[model samples]
Target: MRQFFSKCPVCGNCTTVTSYKCKSCGTEIRGEFEPNEFNNLSKEDLEFLRTYLRNRGNLTKVAERFKISYPTAHSYFNRVLAKLGYLQSESFHYAEILEKLEKDQIDFSTALSLIKEEKEVKP
Candidate 1:
């Protein structure tokens, strides 16, 4: 059986499903079935997502496991997050760090030191 292509061959528009047929009994029934979104994910993206989850969202561990650099692992993770609509802005990261500091999980001195370091790194 030929797999259904999502795009029309002639015009490149999205192809619509109008009907369905059973292979064994020749039974037919169909109208407007939604394709599963998961079907749209490439195998490599799925594998990356799986490995990322398996590593408990640790980029360092993921990099080590895949023999990639930490920056490469972080880039891949950020790309996936962007695809999934979960990417965070720099402001959001700063807010999260502030929240951690407020909760006493990070010391105020450490937070101030990081802020000073970030300022120094800025052009």
Candidate 2:
């Protein structure tokens, strides 16, 4: 048996998955099946998410624990969310607004207004 590295040949992306084959029966399956979200994450991302969760979603604490800057920790959290498919480029800004609203830093009306303003600015 040989081990295959899960990476893209052209782009060098690391999110590849292995296919299974039955040599005896000549049965084969190409491409990756639907796996859990965590499986799609790299080892580094998984470690970051674990530490972030351990810090109770506190980016400041996570940064202190990891000895990284707050912005770096926050970026890692966003990257993990993106890898898990919980975030999309178009929705990230809105989601951040929602998070601010949840934290009571921004009122609901302000969030709605911001969303409207964004929609108006969209080309």
Candidate 3:
């Protein structure tokens, strides 16, 4: 199946869906519809997301699977989070840091440093 282009070829702008058709029922809907954020993700980003999910968000496993460093995997993970609108103005919380440590996404030292940094910023 051919994938629809989410971006306009000429202007390089995001394209909006104006219509949809059903293959079997011969039904059609026409209106201005916004594409989801997933549509904005590149093929590589999707692949990375898939790999990360398949590994259950374990950065160590993701790094090993991609033959990259742990920090690199973490960086890629953060980038995906940003693309998905998960990383807003605030940094990761203390619970999130502990969760990452539990999931082996970050080492104990890294988690500690992040917690320390967060503490310093807040207090």
lDDT of each: 0.69, 0.75, 0.80
TM-scores of all candidate predictions against the true structure? 0.46, 0.49, 0.67
* Residues 1-123 of candidate 3: C-alpha lDDT, one tens digit per residue: 678778998999989989999999989999999888888888988899999889888989999999987866776677777778887534535556766786798999999999888778874
Each candidate's clash count: 0, 0, 0
Give the range of the ten consecutive residues with the poorest summed lDDT in model 1.
88-97
By the TM-score metric, which is better: model 2 or model 3?
A: 3
Model 3 RMSD in angstroms: 6.2
Best by lDDT: 3
Among residues 3 or more apart in sequence or in different chains, the pairs in candidate 3 whose N, CA or C atoms overlap within 3 Å are none
Q: Against the true structure, whose TM-score is highest?
A: 3
* Model 1 agreement with the true structure over 29-122: per-residue lDDT tens digits: 8798655544344567668888888988887888898887775666666666655556755434455556567667889898888777766766
Candidate 1 ranges beyond 4 A from true positions: 1-30, 88-123
Q: Could you tell which candidate, 1 or 2, scores higher by lDDT?
A: 2
